[model samples]
Target chain A: MINEGCRLMVVDDELIVCKRLKQILEKAGYDVTVFNNGEDAVKKLELESYDIIVTDLKMEGVDGMKILETAKRKNPDTRVIMITGFAETETAREAFRKGVFDFISKPVEIDTIKQVIIKAQKEISGSKT
Target chain B: MRLRIWHKMIIGMAIPSFIALLGVLLSYGYIDDVQKRHGYEQIADNINDHVLEVRQNENYFFHFKNGRFLDKLHKAILDLKNSVNKISSYTVEEIGKEDFALLQDAIRTYPPLINDLYDNYLEETNVTEKVRAEGRKLESFVAEKNRTSELTSSFILHLRLLEKNYMLFRNEKSFNALNSKLTEMKKLTPHCFECNPYIEAIHNLFETYKKSDALVAEIQLTGDRLEEITRRMAQRERQRIGSFLTKTKLLLAAALVLLSTLGPLFVYKTATYIVAPIIRLAEITKKISEGNMTLRAPLREHDETYFLATSFNTMLDKLQLTYNSLERSIELLNEKQAQLVDSEKRASIGLLVAGVAHELNNPLYNISLTVDAMKDELNELTEEKISEYIEDISSQSKRAHDIIDNLLDFARARKSTEMEKQNIVRIVKESFNLVANQMRINNIKLEQDLPDEPLFIKGNHSKLEQILVSILTNAIQAMKGNGTLRVSLRPDPESNRIVLKISDNGQGIPEEEIRNIFEPFFTTKPVGQGTGLGLSVCRSLVREHNGEIEVESKLGEGTTVTLKFPQYKENA
Candidate 1:
């Protein structure tokens, strides 16, 4: 498929969240970069662009909204997915208005994330043609 | 006697009136008796007057020497007897008993003696006439004898003159002179036989004169006795009248004395009986005014004041009833206020748990996905990879367990009021976790300046947590987008107290409004947004923790809440 090996970035304040997402998404055949904190994820976003960005909504310094804004500003085609420990939060409502591609609450199903990424991959490939 | 005021007054007036009535009756009796005595005196005086009339007529009889004078004297005596009987009718009953009887006895003897004198006078007159007639016959016989007859006739005229003198005087001296003259005449005319007849006439005349003199003496004695009896009757009447007046005076003075002394005494007794209950009620009213509400007026009198006391006591009862009801309402209001505080606590817990549960979902989702991946790779996965998956499952489980345990600790301690030495740092973190999601969602930053060293305080863990939660909730509410909530905890070395401070960079309270911020029902938040009991409830909870809370703010700048508690020295 045209979406195989598409570059993706994951950001969260929890280390286990980053580690598990990287391992599972790599085996599914997509390029994955994990960040334990939103600050590093946000800095990395400025330096290198990604096809997709998955980030935690709440972080110590740079929250998910900041990252979402930066990722969209640099590349409008870049799909930013927001992940949060809290489901249906006020920030989550605002995140959609900010053009977030997807939202995932904590204790997420890794399969659901994969299927969502696949859907994004098919759309991105179709758009480039 | 259940007397009304008017009844007592009437009795008071009637006492003097009764005395006056007694005095009037006694006076009337005295006057009536005096009139009767006057009549009795008049009766006694009339008896004496009739006796005087009898004496005057008897004198007329003796002076005139007439038959008509004797009839008049007898009529006067009869009139005296009638008057004596009239006076005697009043004797022993009104006055003069013994003296009147004596007078009656004297009057009884008077008429008899008067009759005897009348009879003697008639005989003396007869004897005198006979003597005169006999002498004249002797003179005629002597007419024949010439010179001797002339001498005898002159001597006979002289003897007749002596008889007339003895009859007119009726005294002892005149009668003795008549006898001597008779003897001298007898001596001169002895030789003349015609002179013998003149001697016989003179002898009978002397006997009649002596009997007339004795009868007059008996009549004079009876008249004297009548006069003496009359004088004594008058004296007895005067003495009896004097005693009657004395008795009347004694009774009248006694009545006056009774009125003057006992009349006022009755009035005073009645007044005291009427006024005592009212005075006692006044004292009771005074005590009630002083706030002793238990007092009541006694139902003492059967008068208008008794009704006043009953109504007054009923008024007191109603007042006490209203007061009791008011107190009960206040107690009920206090209970409702306590329930409101409890509800506030529950609302805060609900908010925390809801957010925390929702917040835990992502980690749980991640662990679930990883477990599914591990199951698919279980046969082909290398030992290192298997260890990684196992590590992920266990760590994630541990993290979920830790979060739930923290929630349980908060919930369990919220109602447990047991005081113990608690770590201020751990408590602060636990309190922050409950509201941290709200902070993150609102894009507000948390700045916790906590010492690595555990600051210890002696307090109820839940109450201390409630203080922090409530203050943090306020701080979170104060802040908006991108606001900062700063929390700091430290132990003061000098005061030996643990101090925790929570501040927010948000809209702050005005200085004047802040004074009322801790008062119940004083809300900076719009109605329904806050119960306004939050700060007051917080202050009380902090006091239960043995802590002091201070809030400082500037309008539009920020609000800082500081808590101070005595540091706990671990006894163990």
Candidate 2:
């Protein structure tokens, strides 16, 4: 079972995607907060510390890359994951260069996303130890 | 004489020489007249001296029978004889027979008469007493005869002396007399000799006295005859000189007329041949200055003027070439400017469509999600009364979802990839299926003329489908109410292209607005009903596949949009 107090932040322009991801992650026994856009996620990251961050790459306002940059700066120990609808090699490379834990392309398979989050959680926990 | 320019100049100089020639003729006439008069005077003087010696010989015989005066008279007689001989000698040298005869008679008769008178005086002085009385009587007779001879001799001497003086005066006075009488003669008779003929009569009277008064008068008469002949010859010479002068004047006047007329003629011909062409060239140059390139100077000759004309024509040709190229360049620049404006219009329309699509996305998504949740909730309710409600909810949700999907699809960014061969018929069927419910709701009758066999095209599948869907949707929208929509897909064998013809029997596009149908954001539909990018996107997509899309329509008639896609070739 996943740790109960482990916190995760989900950022996306699509409110449904963010809510769905948060609900799925919560059901997996992780504490989760959902943000409709990257700007809101960055504001929340300033106040509270998180174990992992998952964000969409393309959005209306601030995007996933900005959230990744801000989250890594605020808490270097936090693990970040990037999700995109379009599979572009340049975006994946950029995300890797930013030291994110994983990069994902959507129509996300739920199992693969679950596994990647679990891996990020394990990394965050290990860092805490 | 060769009449060169210098010859003409010399002839011009002869005009003044002609005046000098007249003066020379006048002086020559005067000198000749003076020489004739002087010769007559010399002959008269010699005759007068001979008469004086004869008178002195008679006086000495009358006074002293054997005196020195007698001897002097005889010697004077001898001297007169010698003078007569000398006159004869002068006459013979001059070949004058009249002067020679006169001198020989004077020498023979005068010397004999003087010897007879001297013998009579000597015989009277030597006579005896008885014959003295007889000799005295004879002496008386001889004395009377001697006195008569002396009287005649003295009178003759006076007449000779007068003749000599007259000849001397005639020689000295003839010129002055002629001059003085000229004015009087002009008033009275217009001829000097006629008005004052007495002067010539006095000269003739002296000439006759010179013949009669002295022993040498015969010599003087010869001289008078000579003078008369010389004067007549001088008159002939003067007449000839005057006629010559008149002829010379007439010739000079004729020559002047000829020169005056001919000189200007020569000058005028030369000017026409040489200077006129130069003047014409200058006029053409002036026209060029005024910017008249079309003015072509006539080429009149094959010389420098002709060459100049050719050169000018060449220059005009060059100018026209430059002007034509400049016009072409300007036309190209205008075309480029129009293209830039068209591209900017497309860019702006694309941005606006993207903005509107983005703004609509969120609300549409929210509505779709709400409908989906309601449908899910309705499905769980267990009541027969709610079964119909669930069905209605499901149907409405599905409708809303479809609308949202259509909007998103229309707003999606179209990035074309490389082309591939695909079945054109299947792509069209799929596109129709995507909008089938909408077509049914509009009650539009759709007609299809699809080929029996599979028709393949070299094109991007998604883009081709999108193009077909957009055209079909536009055709449906144009019909609005119930109308027929016809689609014909056929292969153009000659061009090797597949032609997709979509025509609608509805309100037709206006002629003025038909050209703008493919322009982005140019639409007649109400806002939110048409995005205006449908036809523009179709055209772009067709172009990407190395194909063309065109439309033909008329007001109140229908529009037909034809898409021609290059046929697929497996080998290619």
Name the top lDDT candidate. 1
Per-residue C-alpha lDDT of model 2 across residues B1-572, encoded as one tens digit per residue: 22333344444555445545555555555555545434544544454466455555545554564656667766776776676566545534443445446545555565555455455444333322223343234334434565533223343333334434543453435434433433333454344232233334433443433322342344234334433433443344455445555555554554455445654555455445555555787798789778876776667755565677778778877987897899899899767644543443343344334433433443443344334444444545558535544564465456556645754554354454567779998888766665554464455677889988999888766567667767777787788746788989999999999998999987889988998998977898888666676777677667878889999987666889998988889888
In candidate 1, how many Å is residue A73 off?
2.3
Q: Write the per-residue lDDT of candidate 1 for residues B1-572, one digit (tens) a residue.
A: 57778887788788888987988798779878877776776776777688788888988987775779989998999898876665445454556556666777777887777677778678767877877788777666655565673366666566567667776675677777778877786676667676666677676666656665566666666777776666556666666677778878887888888888887887787788778888989999999999999999988788878888999999999999998999999899778865765866775676567766865675586588678778656678999988887888887788777777766766663555678888889989888887876776667888889999887888777777777787888888888667999988888999988888899989998888989988988888877677777888888778877779899998889999999988887783
Listing candidates in order, what is each one's chain A TM-score?
0.91, 0.92
Off by over 4 Å in 1: A87-94, B1-334, B376-379, B413-426, B451-458, B491-498, B510-513, B521-531, B566-572
**lDDT, candidate 2, residue B480?**
74
User: Best-fitting candidate, measured by DockQ?
Assistant: 1
TM-score of each: 0.51, 0.28
User: Candidate 1's error at B572, in angstroms?
Assistant: 18
What's the distance in Å from true for residue B132, model 1?
A: 99
Q: Rate the local accuracy (lDDT) of all candidates.
A: 0.78, 0.62
lDDT of 1 by residue, A1-129 (tens): 444669999988877777777877877777899988878887888898999988888777888889999999988888888777665656767898888988876666777787778777777777999
